[model samples]
Structure formats: C-alpha cells, structure tokens
Target: MTQYTQKVNETTLKMPVALLQVGMFVCRLDRPWLGTPFLMQGFLIDNRETLQSVRALCSHVFVDPNKSLIQLRSPRERRRSRRETPEPPTLSPTVDRDMARLGLREVLPTYTRTLKGVKQALREVGRGHPLNPERLAGQVDECINALIDNIPAMTWLSRVKSHDDYTYEHAMHVSLLCMVFGIHCGWPRHEVRQAGLAGLLFDLGKLRIPKALLGKPTPLAETEWQLFREHPKWTRYLLEKSGFEQDVVMACYYHHERPDGRGYPVRKLGTQVPLAARLIHILDAFDAMISYRPYAQQRTVYEAIRVLYHGRNSQFDAALVDQFIELMGVYPMGTLVELSSGEVAVVIGQNHDARLLPKVAIIRDRNKNPVAEHVVNLKQLRDAEGKARFRVKSMLLDGSYGVYMQEYTRHLVLDASPA
Candidate 1:
C-alpha cells in the first residue's frame, strides 16, 4: 500500500498550485469564485481539467485534509511541521484627558471648514439638486478625523451654536456628535464616517417640509403631522435616488422609529432597529430639545439630557442611552451653570478624567452682572489654601440669566460663521 501521512482531525491548509492533486478537495479560491464562470460548492480536483480551471483563476487555494481522498505530505514532512505564530493585533489606547481636550481644540479650524461645506451642500439639496456625494463624503472624512484626534475643540464648537443659525447649524451639530458618539462606541474609522454622513443627512426630508408647518407655535394639525411623520421615508427615497449607500439610506429611513414600536413609519423595536438609526434618533431628539426653535422654548442642556434618560427603554436604546449620558454628561457644554463660588458660567468643555469638574467660561459674577468673561478649567482651579476650588451648584436654564452668548464665545480664535 502507498504510504500516507498520518491524518488527524479536519484541518485547512494553504497549498501552492503546483502541488495540487486529483484527490485533493479544494476549500476556497483566493479570488471570489462567483466572479468566475466555474460554479460549485467546492470541487474535488479529480482530473487535470479541474486543476487547470482552478489554477487559471487562483494562484493558490485552501484545501481540507480530511476531505481529501489522498494524504498531502510525507510522514517526515508532517512530523517536521510546526505551528506558525500569528502576530498579535496592535491596539491603540485613547489619549490621556488633557491631551484629548487639547486635541479637540486643535481641530476647530477643520470643523469650521467642514461646517461651511456642509451648509452649502444642504442649501443645494434643498433647492432640488442632489447633494454631491463626493462633497458630503469629504466632509464626513474631515469630521471623523477631527473627532479621532481629540474631542474637546469639536465638543466646544458644537455648543457655540447660535439660535439665529439653528436651521444651518442643526445638521452640522448632529453630524459632529455622531462621529464623537461612534468613536465612544468603539467603531472603526470607516464606520465612524458612515455614522457622520448618516447623521448629516438624517433630517434631509425636513428641509422639504414647509417652514410654516415647522415654525407653527401651536401643535401641528393632523395634515401637517402626517407630513412630518412621512419625512423619514422621503429622506430614504431621496438618498437612494442620490446613490447613497445602504447604511446611510437605512439610517435615514428608520431614524424616527421608536424602541417601543410607537415611532413613525416602520416602528421597529429595540435591537431590531439599525444602530445608526437609533443613534441618530437619540441625537436628533437631543438637538431639537436644546435648540431654540420658533415653536418650542429651548430646553436647558440639563433638561434635555434628563428627558433622554427618562425615555431610554421606550424612545431610545437603553445601552446607547447610558453611553450617551456618560459621553455628554449631566453638565455638558453649553449648559449655563452656577458655581459654588457664586459665579455664573457656561460649560465650555469637559475634563474627560473628571467629568463633573468641566471647564467653564465665567460669563457673570456672583452679583449676576456681566464681567470680563474668561475660561476656568475646574480641574486646574485651586483656592488660596491649595484645596480644589469651584464645584457646580446647579445648571440654570438657557436665558434664565441673560448675557450675550456669541460675545462670550467670540475669542480671537472665533470670527464670523464660515462663509
């Protein structure tokens, strides 16, 4: 009898084309088999024609030893084989707190650029032209890169939104937050970009909604309400017609769906919902809550966050709700807060390591009078006695204590909104 290498349990081996034999059972082709004319689950290379067909399409193939009718290697070669060591995957740890904050600040100019481009794209699309997919893609790349570098500056800029620019800024804010949220969820770079693009376009259908309906102070009538409910499907159709990818299309379509199956259109429930859609839904609601819309009084950042927490299981995904709360924090940026020092300040940024002790810009003094506004990073402040100074007393609602928000944030680094 012909000598054969001792067989063990089923094992896969990468074999060169020259070594293939009639009894070898092919497992996988190096290239896509569907692209080739040959169609089979896998073939037993029992003849020269079969071997020739495979070699024509692939430089090498995977073979199963157990499936092969004949043994592949001699006993000496089998005994000599040793397992190859696979290199461990390289992991990158997120930057330290201070560095990350600095990184966020450094990307503001990039954000300004992307924001300008996005606003223009939206305008064109609202005018009935399809958004240039390439342009939107470039902005998404810039956004993802900025968020990956450091979250502070972008986080800070997101809060600098002006009520006057609410229409233009809402999309930009959602897009930025989506990238940040995606990174928090440990998504890969490309996936983060996908989230960003989806977010920027999630409200595209609303652009087509008559401004009169959107701006009505009273509740929307049933006809107007029906139009609002239909926006998600409209957005999905527009995106599909515009050649948007499946991820973006589905995210836009299902974003308004509720976790409790009460949401508009599809009414998808829980994990059945697309992750992108769920994330955009949470962020969309958050932005709308905090925005100074013509119809609704702007809710304080604290108040909006409270609402999100309250609706977690029914209106939003519970895990994502927790993650977002931790990400945005109870005292997130733009929150107008009073310090134990009797100072009134607007939250400017967060100290990642010390979330409760965020950086704030002192807009008013203990007497509630406007002062020479300056930033006080809570983590760095200390009393004359060398003890940490300044804890948040309570977050005041927007407009409760009035001051010019634009002027306070208008540092040398900030100028007019990008053209």
Candidate 2:
C-alpha cells in the first residue's frame, strides 16, 4: 500500500467530541467552522473546554492524525465523511413498549444490589483470582430480571459514572445495556441473561495487560497497541479456566469484531461474528462513548447514538443500530439538555408505553435561573392548546447551565419528602 493511503487509514476517522483528548489535532467539525472558537483549520485539543466547545457545536468531527499524545483511540466509523441525517428519534411501533419497564419499584432492589456483586467479582479477576462464572451468571440473572422489571432505574444507574472505577463500572453498565437491549428486542429471559453475562465478561482479557499500558493517560505507542489487541486470547483462557459457558467465552472473544471484518482478534465479518458478541459490541461502544475515561473525552448521549447510527451496515449491524436508536430515542434518560422553552433539565426517566419522551428534572428556568426543581413527564405534558409540552432545542454539555443529574436527583428526593 502507498504511504499516503496507509496514513489516511491510520489517521482520519469520525469521532465524537467526548472521546477527543488533549494533543489530538481536530481537522473537521460536524458543521461549519465559521462560528466556532478555533481560528486555524486544525488545532491541538488543549483543555476540557475544547471538548465542551466542540460538543456544543456538533455531534461528531473528523479527527485526522496518525497518532495521539493522550493515547486515545478513535471509534470506528460506519461511513467515510459527508455526514448523513440522523435517524428520526422515534420508537419502534412493534416493540412491547413496556418490555422492561414493568414493576419498576418492586424490582429496584435486585437491580441495585447486582452492581455491587459484579464490581467485587471483577476486582477479584483483576487480582488474578479465578472468576466465579456462576456468580457472574447469577448477577447477570439479577441484571436481566431487574431490567425486565424496571428498565428506567437500571438504565439510569448505568449513566451514573466514576472515573476511578471505569473498568468495573463499564462492565456493569454494558451488562445492563445488553440486558435492556435483549428485553427490548423481545428476546426470552434466558437469551437476555446470556447477553448480559457476555457484557459482564467482555473485558476479562484486558485484566492481563500491564497496568502501565491499560492505564496510560497519553496515546500509546505502536507496540502498546499491538499488546492491547492480544488480550482476547487471554480473556478466552480466563473464561474457560473459570468454567463460563462456551457461548459466553466466545462472546468476549469477539466483542471487538466488526461486521465488515475490520475489528480485532478474529476479524470475522458479518454473521461470522456470534450474535452475543454482536450485541455486546454495540452496547460496549455506546457505554465507552458516553462515559468519561481518563484516556478519552465523553460524548453526549445524542453524539454517541449518532455515531452508532452512522456506523451501521458499514461498521455495525444496521438493524441493531436502528433498534438502539429506537430504544434510546432522541434523548436517553439522564441526558442534560436545553428545552425549546429555554429551561435546563436532566432526563430522569423514560415513558415505556410509547414514544421516547423522557421525564426530565427542570433545574433551571428559561431565563437561566436556578429554579426549584420539579419533574415533568414529556409524554403526558401538554400546553393549554395540547401540543407536545416541549421539545429539546439541543443536547447540552452535562454540567452546563449548572445541571448535574446526580446532585439534582438527590435534592429532588429530599424536596419531595414531607417536612
């Protein structure tokens, strides 16, 4: 191959603003550059604001570089440039609507406790202890049951993140995402649990990699990259050693594989990838994109969904991506947003019966004042004339307009309590 072609393949990819890190050269935006903060055509990302500024502008951008100093890697793109329209943020008419949204309050306990169990098991695996595959399976069961009962709570918990516990928490979140997806697709309980187990075990192989490489704050060297992809074999060995089902082991082995055969390890294309692996791959990418990692920036829920949408067919299963968009809707729960009414809010819950009009905590007034927060369910909300109560003007940066979901949720509970 010519050097230029190699450089282009090695360099440019469509990346969400959240994953962009300091020192990477951002060569393009999702929109025009005329109104942006940058003066030059391409500039090094210097600080946190660079990402906040970029996210405020567009969902994705062209990041052109052979490498990065932050050791950050680009998410695989489904299309090559020329942004396509995002799928209309709508729900599938065929879905059960209340697939996992049933009996939420009663099932909340099972969902909350399973995360702690999974975290402890993963920590043991990191220390080279044997994985209790059965224990993991049980947690997967709990996870699936929890989602099967109360999707909004499980989904909301998934969005609550911690930078220090990223690996463990990511595994837990991905597991929840997979279970939710399975339930959404009308999969049987056994199938849903299997998918959840696979998500929990997706990164078992990475535990074998050296901490220096895994924890590197800067862009990794070519050698480190080589070392990174070899963890699949290690993961397989660990899973087998721990007596996980063969299907579960294979899922972890191929979660990084893509539909076009462009992914790592086996590089199997299309249906050659296991179905469990395919489901895990999409949610894994979704969680990684939305969550903060020391190595990469975090994208908004919209940006992450859009990247996944554009990647369909070429980089991911087109049908699965569509289902994911349909599932998460235009705004997933916990998303901080600016409404057309000029109110600042955080999505707190989702309507299960129909549509993706999520419930939001209105934290700031249209005039941008800190308001006494109250919840609004978008689906039922109607103006005097009876239109959709409000629309999201644009997805906002998480902490912008002084709205943080965790803090807002805490106060919400307290304020609702009787004196």
Candidate 3:
C-alpha cells in the first residue's frame, strides 16, 4: 500500500503550482498553474476561483501536471472502458421501511444497564453466596452486541461517573478493548461475545486474594507470592460453586497462562492453553500495561502495544500478537502522536492498509498552540501525482505533551465540544 504523511493546517507553497501542507500533519498538491500542471507541497490556500471554474467544466476536477487545463471526458466514457464492473445494489422502499423498524437508541441504555449489572454480579461473587455466572455471561453478550453496533458512531468513550469499584470497572474496560480487537479480526458475533465475557471475568481470581494484597503498591514477599499463585485455583473453585460452565471457568483460571509455559498457575504451554484463555491473557496484559497502578504511572497505548509486539514469541502468542497489532494499529486508541508536518493529534481509529497513516484529528501545532476543534481525514487527501501526501515519522506519549489520557478521556466524553 502507498505510505502517506499526516499534516496540520500549515501549508508550504512551491512557487506557482505546488503546495505542501506540513506540520504534525502533511499534504501535497500538484495542480495546473496558468496553462501547465504544477506540483505544490501544501493545502489549497487560493483555489476558490479555480475550483468554481473547474466545477463548471467537469463533474469532478482533478489536477494534472503536464497540462495547464485539460477537459476530461464524462463518466460514460470511463464506464465503457472498464474490464470488470460490479453492479450497484438496488435500494427499495421496503428496505428503507425495514430499517426504520429497527430501534437503536432503545438498546443503548439497556446494554449500559446490563454492563452495570454484570459488574455488580462480579463484585458480589465471593462476598457471600456465589454470584450468577450465567447472568454475568448474558450481560457480557448484550454489552458486546451493543458495542459492535455502536462502534462506528462512538468517536470517544462515554461519560460515565468514575467508580471506585476497580475490579468490575477494569473487567468491563478489558472486555471492551478485547471486543474492539475481535471486531477488527472479523470474528463471528458469537465468538466475539464469548471473548468479551472471558475478558470481563479473567481477573476473577484476584477477588479471592486478600483486599490488602490486592491493593498493595509494593512487590509481594515469598509467602505472599505463594498465596498469589493459588488465586487461580480459588477462582476456579468460586466459578464451579457458582455453576459456571467448565469452559468459562477454565478461561478465567488460565487467562494468565502463557504460550511459552512461563506464566503463573499451571505453566501450561502452547495448545494446552485454550484459544479463549490465550486471547484473554494478551488483553489482560495490555490493559494492565496501559492502566495506572498504585506503584507505576500508566504507559501510552502505543508504548504498551510496542512492548507487547516486541515480546510476541516469548511473553505472548505470536499469532495473537500479530492479530492484536492489526486490531489496534501502530498507534492504538488513547495514543498521542506528532505528525511529520509538526502538528499533534490523537489516533482515534486504525487504517489497516496504512498502519503508519491512520486517521488523526489535529489538536496542536509545532509551537504547541491549541487548534482543538479540527478533524482531519488523512487517508482522503493526495498529492499532484495522486500519491499520498504525508507520512508519520514518530509516535509520542500523551504525558510528553502534558496530556493525561484518562483525564482527557473524561473531558472528551463529558464536554459537549472537542477540547
């Protein structure tokens, strides 16, 4: 695939024809000047008159370097020369009517409530009688479906009140992240739901540990470590007591197991670890790396992903690592990046074919001046030769830019406008 750079609003004009828009983001333009096509290295700063004139002459206006002004043939001519063509889908009134029958907004709150209930159930697990494992599973299934259906529309995390309930909240976040990976992998709906449930409950073992140990900022001593090793077994007992399916209980018990047999508990290796368990292990590690612990600051998503990628064969399953990389992109969600053009933006989504050139929304310039209200689709713009205009030179952590991602996430979801 073609590699492109990201640019901000800054544009550099190359004499008469070329315009180069460079910053944290970059775009190049080569268009005809006077009578011949010219190449520029910037955004269109003075094309209002030219754009209007070209629009009058053709249905679509494209820049040409060799010619000053060329009249292109109509769409009919292009259609006639096609080697192969797929027919456009026919839209019917019945299809539109059927779509109208679906109620989307009615489902969002229901799913959100279900997530809350799942968290409650997980929290209640070892406190008294065992919680309902089947109900928790059902809640997870609902949340996954809701998330998949809303992914395209969800530009940022929702503004729910911050809960001191760490275990349940963390479980929910991990499940959501795993679901994102699952969607990227094109997993079937059923499989994705199962993965989400596994992710949510992967840390059930932690609940069996003493509250003091769970909250400790210091490293565990030998005796404490010995107790830590048994948490998985305790977790399995808890699940079995709650009447969970064997597979679900195993998924929770073995989530920490590694492919290299280097992980905790049984130290099972490779195929001995179930697929659900393996995926949960990777997701669990990723969530831990990016999340703040009492002893350490959180790492950026990009940094955590890099650590995971580098440790693929040893620390994680190689194939699952590759799939996760593809799922999250080079700059995963919550990553702050500086573009080659010198503008800074947060990566909100992945561009699969262009890992290095995912879509970014510009927020700051080279001088760190705020330009908070802009959104740029880096994949849509091209150069004079119809080539991608910008490239991503490096990825930066949000902390380096004086941005706290969790705080930012809070503001993004709560504030009505982009800040």
Candidate 4:
C-alpha cells in the first residue's frame, strides 16, 4: 500500500490509500488532474475501503500542503519543464481595460437581438427541435458577458428597463442578476458563467409545457401546479438529451429548489443542492420580483431586495443574500429616488468613497420640471459643516413615471451632464 500525506482543514493526516471514504476530506494532490487544484468539501466518506479504492485508481500521488506550490521530485526535470512551459502572463490590466471597453460598447442593441434569439430558440424547442444546446450556450455567454461588464452605473435605477419581448427579456434579466449574485458568493469566473447560463435556461423546460398553461394569467390549478413543479425534471431530461454537462444540467434543473426542502421535484435541503443552483435561485427570484409579469405588479428593487433578505436561510443562503445586498447596494443602478433636498434623481454610479452616497442625476425637483441635468457625486458634496445633506427618501419604478427603463437609461447615460 502506498502511503500519502493529505491535508484536511489545515491539519495533515498520514494514511494509506485504502482508508479513504466518500466524505473523507482531502486537499488537492501536488499534481492535479486538470485546471486549478480544489480542496474537497463536504464529500461523503462512506468507508475506509473507499479511500483505498481511490488510491488504486491513480498511478502516482504527491503530497503538498501549500495550494500554490507544485512539488516535482527531480530538480533537473522541473528546470527543464519550467524552461519549456513559461507561465501565462498576468491579466489584471488587460482584463480591466477589456471589461471597460465591453461596458461602453453599445450592448443594448446586442441585448435586444439576443432576447429575440432566445424567444426564437424557445419557439423552436416548443415545436420539438432538439433543444439546441450549442446555440443556447452561445446566447448565455453573450448575455452574461454583457451584464457583468455593465452592471448599470450607480445612478440610473429607473433607466434599467426591460425589453418588450417578455420571455427573452426575462431570460437576460435573470442571467444578469444571477451573475451579480454569483460574484457576491465569491464564485470564480467559470462558475459565474455557469450560473448565468443556468439562469438563462432555468425555465427552458417551460417550452415542453403547454403554451396555454404557460400564458395563463389566472392562478394555476392544483393539477396544473403539479405539472409546473415537474418542469425541473423535464429540464434535466432536455439537458441530458442535448448533451449538456452535469454541472450545467444540475444548475438549470435545480434553480427553483429551496434550501429548506420546500422546493419541488427534489425537495433537496442545505448542501444537498449544488452551490450554483442555490446562487441561481436567489438571483432568479430577484429578477422575477423586479419584473412586471402579465398578472403581477412589479416590485421596486428595494422592496425586492427586502423580500430576498427576509427569505434568508429559509429560501436562500444568508451569507450570499447579505453579499448580494452589499454588491447591489441599498439603491442599485437604475433606481429612481426622491432626495431629502426635494429633488428626484436616478442613481447612476456608486461612490467609491461612501457607498451610501452614490452619484445621481437630478431629473426633477419639488415642482417636477424637466431641468438642466448635472451629475452629483454625493460623496464629494456635503452640507454646511461637511455632513451629508441629501438622503434617499423613496424608490420609484419606471411605470410610475410613465417611462420605459430602456429608453430612460439611454437618455440618462447619453444626455446627462457630467458632474
């Protein structure tokens, strides 16, 4: 039997290969199979024999306590390997510039087009086409990249508008929201992308359901609700049939499953549900809350956030929920607010200095006239002795002002004067 030293929770354990079980914790081997080495978390350690079995499965294993260091037995071989394979260049500056450019490139047009594509894809699926996973994946990536690069400037709350195509628009919105939530949960870029894809396709199974039922403005009947609950299973089936990977399929199927076992099709609780699924669930609900459905009135972002916070532990992960609140701030981009100064403005950007005092563009005053616009960096400006003079009193929705968010956002970003 080959002896190996494994690190678990910062403590090193010396054991033979045969003693490992499903739940037995193990740090990454000195050499990983692929990509970044990951520490195993919460796996099932069924029996000692299982541990030995895993050892048999691998030909060679090396132990390393440090996650970043690779231990090569032969210094000569290591030197040769390093000479042949140089490390990839660092990407911080490049990534930052790329992200900024992506944000500024007029993505709304592309977003509108992608929305149409999603609707079209759904229609094709409804008509029994093979549920084109490749096409759907491409669309998912596009939507995610767009949203991540542009999370609405801190000031433009009312301007964050939904498109006319409800189905596709809803998909894009959910994808964006899920991306934000995933970032809050400290998910890596790949996981965040997966979460976005999952959110975009979370309701893909709805294509299999009857259009009449899906479009019903009335409350679902008991039987209809049962059918609705089975959508996740249908989603899993579709994903499997389309050859989607397991992680992607699980995320798509389990986004509706609550953490407390009250969710449908699986009733999985706590860690039973994948992290990707849980992240998507929180974001999916957030998007739905801000959305105006055919039968339900839209909730303001603040109100929607409150609902999410209230559902912590029961419906969502509490830490993730808190992080999400911090990520979006109390007043997110595109939110309209009434300031204490008797002025109405749209939140445009977050002030790096004081999160509470975001930059705003005044759109109306006490008399409610369309006036000359100027950017107000709330962090820099203050009252008499340098105290905050303005405070947000209320958040308003686009419908309340008889404006569409998409149009309003364009005007705000393009026409508003810089402060």
Using all chains and alpha carbons, the TM-scores for the candidates as numbered come to 0.70, 0.70, 0.67, 0.69
Full ranking by lDDT: 1, 2, 4, 3
The window of 10 residues in a row where model 2 has the poorest summed lDDT is 92-101
Q: What are the lDDT figures for the candidates, one per model?
A: 0.75, 0.73, 0.60, 0.65
Which residue ranges in model 4 land beyond 4 Å of their true spot? 1-105, 143-159, 183-186, 412-419
lDDT of 1 by residue, 12-80 (tens): 776756457788998777788777866886778898788777766766777887789997764456546
The clash numbers for all candidates, in the given order, read 2, 10, 27, 25
* Per-residue alpha-carbon lDDT of candidate 2 for residues 1-419, written as tens digits (9 for 90 to 100): 11011123556766655445667778777777787778887777777667667756766677776544555333323233214645333333112123222333345467557767877876887788888877777778867766765777678767767556788788888888888888989998877877888888888888789988997989989999999999988989988999988888899999889988899897899888888898788999988988777787788888888899889977888888898888877778767888889998777666543245666767789999998656666765655533566777778765677666556544444443446
Q: How far out, in Å, is residue 339 in model 3? A: 2.3
Ten-residue region with minimum lDDT total, candidate 1: 88-97
By the lDDT metric, which is better: model 1 or model 3? 1
Give the CA lDDT, 0 to 100, for residue 353 in model 1.
Answer: 46
How much lDDT does candidate 4 score? Answer: 0.65
- Candidate 1 overall lDDT versus native: 0.75
- As for candidate 1, its clashing pairs are 104-153, 105-153
At residue 127, give the lDDT of candidate 2: 84
Q: Per-residue lDDT tens digits of candidate 4, residues 179-275?
A: 6666656678778777767777778888778878887889999999999888888888877887877898998787888878998777889778888
Supply candidate 3's per-residue lDDT for 221: 94
Show where candidate 1 strays beyond 4 Å.
Answer: 1-105, 374-389, 398-400, 412-419
